[model samples]
Target: MATHASAEKRNRQRIKRTARNRAAKSELRTTLKKARNSVKTSAQDASTATVTAQSQLDRAASRGVIPKERASRLKARLAKSLHKATAKLAAAS
Candidate 1:
């Protein structure tokens, strides 16, 4: 319940931004999940999947939706997971 004129405009801006914000966040999560799934499904696909995930993370960082360092950290962790999974697969085979 903003009574001021400026507050009304701010509310409008918030409304418009909400959808885009949600979309961006959702896209980021979906990309990350897809990458993780791809890695888990095929040891051979890990490299390509990691690459795709890195791209998605970089895009998000560049757009200011996420910090570059945070994106890099996530990428690093994902790659590490992929590596560990691949190593396990190799050991098992």
Candidate 2:
């Protein structure tokens, strides 16, 4: 229990921030998963999903929910995988 009023206020802020961050992280995971799955399924649809995921990542990073470098890394990897997958499909045709 917080003995001081300031401490109690800080605790409340922490609780709210935690909840918001958790929701952002959860949504981020879901977006990433959808991007990965789309990459495995179809290149056309995968591009759209990847873009959406990248946008979400940037938003999260900007909000401080995730690090900027980490978000950039993830976006790069997603783009790389998408390119490789599309290339493989192109070669197959």
**TM-scores of the models, in the order given:** 0.78, 0.98
Q: Residue 7's C-alpha lDDT in candidate 1?
A: 100
lDDT of 2 by residue, 12-91 (tens): 99999999999999999999999999999999899999999999999999999999999999999999999999999999
Per-candidate RMSD vs. true structure? 2.1, 0.6
Model 1, position 44, has a per-residue lDDT of 89
Whole-model alpha-carbon lDDT for candidate 1:
0.88
lDDT of each: 0.88, 0.98
Q: What is the TM-score of candidate 1?
A: 0.78
Pairs with steric clashes in candidate 1: none
Off by more than 4 A, model 1:
88-93
Clashing pairs in 2: none
